[model samples]
Structures are given as structure tokens and as C-alpha cells.
Target chain A: DARVTQTPRHKVTEMGQEVTMRCQPILGHNTVFWYRQTMMQGLELLAYFRNRAPLDDSGMPKDRFSAEMPDATLATLKIQPSEPRDSAVYFCASGPMSSGNTIYFGEGSWLTVV
Target chain B: GESVGLHLPTLSVQEGDNSIINCAYSNSASDYFIWYKQESGKGPQFIIDIRSNMDKRQGQRVTVLLNKTVKHLSLQIAATQPGDSAVYFCAEKDWSGGTSYGKLTFGQGTILTVHP
Candidate 1:
């Protein structure tokens, strides 16, 4: 159906390696969000984007983390020189800005950085 | 920072029984609250939501209660089933910021297990 889709459902990479997670939001969704979930921090919003433009990335560590929506159908979260602490489940969600604040999430990408 | 948090880390319920999961929010400015269920290896699924103007709202076999006075929220599941077992999370949105923006602050989830 009309559900958000994520690529590379699971990933294992060594520290200092580059990792990229991709998401395909549901059609017509204008707002996309990136979140990280860990046992210690729970679910935290890492970034927010509207209409393919980033509106907030305050929660993300700009030094290595970057989020971008190359097109309406593709949103990507990339980590350069990834560290062990970056290991966690990353989720991508999309929703309409005007409709009730309901965000539809993709299954999620389980990243393990050694 | 997380605006919502849970009072309990886990809850166990018997099949056909009712289960209640509680959450507390730190921001009083929050106007919309929602509950979601996440199964193992799956994304969080929308359960239900309630507005600050209303005290309670119900959907299908689930009911959400919002206590604006105490900044508390609760989700009640009627006749718990095995399929309902999952981690439940409560999220809040602050519309007082002047823009809905679809920003949702989520809480540390509570794991619920239904015993058949």
C-alpha cells in the first residue's frame, strides 16, 4: 500500500566507515523526519524536512550526520566517519503538514557500527 | 530532550483482560498526544490520539485518556490479544509554537506482553 519504505533493512559497518540509509516516503507526503532509537536514549528526533528542504537538524551532530531529500521519492541519512556510538536503529517517517499530525514510518534500518 | 516518559517499563496482561499503559509529559504547552505500538523488527504503528481540549477519545478497541492538569496520558486496550504485544510509546506535539510542523516528541516506550 502507501507506506514509507526503507533500504538496506540492516547494515554492519566498521568504525570510520561511511554509512548511508535511504528512505522512500509515501506519495504526497511533504514532511519527512529522521529518528534514532537506542536502548539508552529511546527514540530521538534527529532531523525534520519539509517540501524537500530541511527545517531542523539541531538534534543531529552536524560534523558527521547529514540528512537530505534528493527528490520527493528519496530521503537519505548519511554518516561520514561513523563511530561506534552511532550504532542504533534509524527510522524515517513522512506525513502531510496540514493533515492531522500523523506520521507514517518505514520499518527502519538497523545499523551496527563496530 | 524527550518531552514524554513512561511510569513503567513493562506491563503483562492476560488475554481478554484490559491493559493500561501510562505516560507523563514535561511540556504543558503540548496540545496533541498520540499513542503508537512497535513490534519487534517493525516500525511504530499509530494507535490513537487525543487533543488537550478533550479528556478522552476511543477508537476500535483502544481508548486514550489525556489529563491536562497532571500532564499525563494513558492508553487502554480492551480484551488484550497476543497480537497486541509490543512496545507502546506516547508522543506529544506542541502546537503552541504557532506551527504544527508535524513535530512529535516521543517517550521511552513500555513493553507490553499479552498472555494467552
Candidate 2:
């Protein structure tokens, strides 16, 4: 079965370190989304891309977080100078626009910043 | 500001019992609703979905009901099993023809625990 693949399923980093999470969306899917999950905030959409173009990143921190789809198969979320508060599970999801709101999610990258 | 919210934060049920999870949305522009189940240490999985034009949709053993008049959504699971224990979330999407089209807004999830 087709599924979204995410790298670094678990990661532990010291504060101020840079963390990068990678994702490979399902083949033939054109839209990708990045979401962060925390106990306090629940799941929040950080950004999304359509056809390899950034659609929105308003939910992400403008200063430290960045999401990019370098190509159709590759999507990445990076945090520079990450802080402890950045610790959370980052999920990548993808779906075709024509699918009518059905999105598939990867296993998620678990990040723990100390 | 528009938001999606759950009626309960947690629900407990016995195996073989039926369970219902309810969600409410504030945005009238939302046209699509989805129910997702997330197990511990895993990402959310799609269960079922319903559109604004439809009142109910059924999947394998799950059903989704949408009431546009009240902006309410619900997920009903028949014959709940122990394996059904997970956090359930409801998401809404706006198809209002803008940059926000297809963007999903998820509600705070409700944790469902099934006692065997």
C-alpha cells in the first residue's frame, strides 16, 4: 500500500541545535502538509505545499521554522536554533486535491529538544 | 476566529458497546468533515468523512454524521473493540474558493478507551 514516509522517527537534540525532518509523500500525490502535535496545543498545521510550491506557512514560527518541498517526492521541515519548546511530534501528510479532503499521514518524527 | 472543538475530552466504553464522539465547528464555510484515529506513538489515521450536503456516511464499522444546520459532526463506532482505543479527532475543511481551500482545521481530540 502507498504511504507517506518520514525520516528520523525519533530524535533528541540539545537546545539551540538545528533539527531537520524529512518526508516523502505518496507517489502521485500533489499536496503535502506539515503538522506539529503537542500535549498543550493538540495538532497544529505548520505549513503545506501544492505542486512543489509553498501554499502557506502561517502556523509556523517565522523566525526559526521553515518547510519546503524541494521536489514532488521530497518535503522537509527544519528548525534552526531549536528550543526546548519546539519539542513535539511532527507529522507529514499528503493527498491529491481531487480526493476531497482525504489525507494520509506518515508515522511522524518524534523530536525532543532539551 | 473560527475553530473546531470536541464535546468531550475523553470517553470510556466496554468492548462490544457502541461509542459516539461529537465535535462542533464554528465556521459555516466548512464543507467537508473527517474523523481520524490516532494510536499511541503513531500518526492519525483516517476513519470516515462526510460532506456538508450529506447527513451521514458509513465506512467499514464506523459512521460519520454531519448536521450543517447546527454545525455538528459525530463519529459512531459499532461493536467497539479493545483495539479501538485511541485518540479521535474531527477535522473540517473550507471549500470557499480561496488560498485556504482544502486546508484542514482539527479539533482537540477525544481519547477513547475501551475496557475489555
Candidate 3:
């Protein structure tokens, strides 16, 4: 099936460590999104890109978090000096840039920072 | 910041019964809305969506209802089964900024428990 693919389905690390998650969006999908899900905040959009160019990342902590689409087939999210509060299931989604297009999501990467 | 929130935090329904989940948003210019179902340890899965111009939309066993006047949205699952248990979220696309980047603001999810 032509679905979004994410790497390292699960990750465990200590505080102050660096973690990176990778995602490959579906082919021909020009828009990619990165989201984080937690018990308290639910699902929040961290960042998004259109045509491989980032449009808005206001939801992300600019100092510790960064999202990049190195290429059309690969999008990466990295967190440096990760804190325990950063632990959450990070999801990558892709779809068109229309008003309310259906976004296809990958199996999220679960990260635990102890 | 603009946000979407749910009315109920959790819901329990007997198997073979119908299930209804509700959500509310603050943005009046939201033109599109979508419903997503997320199971434990997985990403959210798209269920259905409705446009501002339309009041309702239906899928195989699921239906989405939108009330633009009240900024309320609902998801209805017919013949709810055990497999239907999940955290359901309603997302809206607010065009108030005049941008169509497909960015969606998601609501706090409602945990649905289906008991057989």
C-alpha cells in the first residue's frame, strides 16, 4: 500500500539527549505535517510544509525542535536536549494543500524521555 | 491560539448500539471539518469530513454532522462494535486568515469505550 512510513516506531532516551524521527510521505503528496499527541494536550500540530518549504512552525519550540523536508520522499523532525515533557507520539501526515483534504498519517513514533 | 475542544472526555457504549461524539470550536470561519479515530499506540485515522456548505456527510458505517451556526461537530457510528473503541477527534480548517495551507486545528479527543 502507498502509505506514509515512519522510522523507529519507538524510542527511549534520557533527558538532554537528542532524538530524531523520520517520515516518508505518500507519493505525489505536496503537503506534509508533523504533530505531537499527549494525554494533556491531545494532538497538536507542530509544523507543516508545502512543496517541501516550511510555511508555519509556530507551534514548535524553535530552540529545541526543528522539522525539515530534506527531499520530497523524506521529512525529518529533530529535538535537541530533549526533556521529559517532550515525550509523546509524533505523527507525520501528508496530503494536498487544499482547504480540507484528507491527510494520510503514518504509524507514529513513540518517544519516551526519562 | 485557536483551538478545538470536545464536550465529553469519555463515552461508553454497549456493543451493537450507536455512538455519538461531540466537539465544539471557536472559529466561525472554519469551512472544512474532519473526524479522526486514533487507537492506542497508533496515529489518528481519518473517518469522515464535511464542508461548511454541507450539513452532513456519511461513510460506510460512520457519519459526520456539522453545525456551522454553533461551531459544533459530531460523529455518529452506527452499530458500534468493540473495534470502534478509540479516541475520536474533530479537526477544523479555519480560513479566517485567508490561507489555505491545509493546516488543521484538532480538538481534544473523546475516548470511546465499546463494551460487548
- Give the 10-residue window scoring lowest on summed lDDT in candidate 2 chain B: B1-10
Interface RMSD score of each model:
4.2, 4.1, 4.2
> What is the C-alpha lDDT profile of model 2 across B40-74, one tens digit per residue?
99999999888888999999889999988889999
Candidate 2, superposed: residue stretches over 4 Å from native: B1-8
Better of 1 and 3 by DockQ: 3
Over B16-102, each residue of candidate 3 has an lDDT whose tens digit, in order, gives 999999999887877889898988878889889898999989899999888887889999999999999999988887666633346
Per-prediction RMSD in angstroms? Answer: 3.7, 3.8, 3.8
- Give the Å shift of residue B23 in candidate 1: 0.8
Whole-model lDDT for model 1 versus the true structure?
0.90
**Model 3 agreement with the true structure over A9-113: per-residue lDDT tens digits:** 999999999999999999999989999987667788999888999988989999999999999999999999899999999999999777767888999999999
lDDT of 1 by residue, B37-98 (tens): 99998999999988788999999999999988888999999999999999999998765543
TM-score of chain B of each: 0.88, 0.91, 0.88
Give the 10-residue window scoring lowest on summed lDDT in candidate 3 chain A: A95-104
Alpha carbon lDDT at B10, candidate 2: 90
lDDT values, one for every candidate: 0.90, 0.91, 0.89
DockQ of 2: 0.49
- A57: Cα error in model 3, Å: 0.5
